[model samples]
Target: MVEVERLFFMGASQSSSSNSNGEVVFKTETPVQFSPTLVSQLADRQNASPVPTSERQSTLDDQIRAKIKDEVGKLRREEEAVQKQIHTALEKENLDRERDGAGELADGTDSGIGAVKSSAALMGDLEEIRGKIERFQVRKSLQDWPQVRESREKLVECYRSHKASSLECWKEVEGFKDSVRTLEKEYFKTLQ
Candidate 1:
């Protein structure tokens, strides 16, 4: 039989020993103790009051609003600075224009008038192009003329009738070609 004893750092002790009959016995000493300050601090923590949910929520809301106000103020200051810079640049440009005797730079109305003139010119150009396109669409092809159409039909009929002897259709072919040439000459004359 063997006997063993153990001691813990927190002031507790455990011992095991064999009795005369070979049975084991265990004994434990006193539990760990706490300093007075530590005990008082733990007691104080247990008794401390907690903030209510509504009060905590309101404090958080106030903090968020303060942050938003700070950010908006920063943005407004930046915007004002930018506006001042633009005004200064415009004033400098106007002074330069006055020195050059260019009439202190034209206002928005003058530029608007120029824009209207440009738009009117663009409309005129568009109208001219449309007229040209209409005229081209209206012009008749030589094949559509009455004399040319008649001769072409005759030539086609003659070729159909003289399938194996296409030479016999020479007269009709020559007549069709002559009609086309005449129409072409008239079209060119009209252009001149």
Candidate 2:
């Protein structure tokens, strides 16, 4: 007589037996309906190992760096676009002022207002013109522009250096964004 034990896996049975001679025999019985292709595929997958932690971390780091670079680039471009809009608005306002000043001067002179003006009044008029020019020259002040530009530059440099992750520069990036927002608000306020 033989003592036998059987184990089952995936619809297959494996058996081991000890015969009277004290020899061991092993037998495996696979289901007739089992597909060899499916078994081989599963076996291959089971045998394949997962990526090492260090390699996986490296890949994640690369992805994060790429994403950060993309975000920074997008922000920089947006900032540039806003700056251009601000410049365009300023130019248009300046041109309007010039045309209005020219028209006002022509109207005043043609209406004989300048012909009757006293020397003191002319001096006051000149002074007023100088004041207007000075105000126009420093219209928005741009006190925040340099700070925003510097912060953006710092963020870009940090990313390029690759010594630190994007998360580390997040505060600087946010600061730049805030500065730009403040500048934009100031610009719009001036327009108003």
- Clash totals for all models, in order? 0, 0
User: What would the C-alpha RMSD of candidate 1 be, to one decimal place?
Assistant: 16.9
TM-score of every candidate relative to the true structure: 0.31, 0.30
Q: Give the TM-score of candidate 1.
A: 0.31
In candidate 2, stretches whose alpha carbon ends up further than 4 angstroms from where it belongs are 1-52, 103-192
Off by over 4 Å in 1: 1-135, 138-144
TM-score of 2: 0.30
Backbone clashes in model 2, listed as residue pairs? none
> What lDDT does candidate 1 reach at residue 88?
100
The alpha-carbon lDDT assigned to residue 36 of candidate 2 equals: 94
lDDT of 1 at 167: 99
Position 35, candidate 1: lDDT? 100
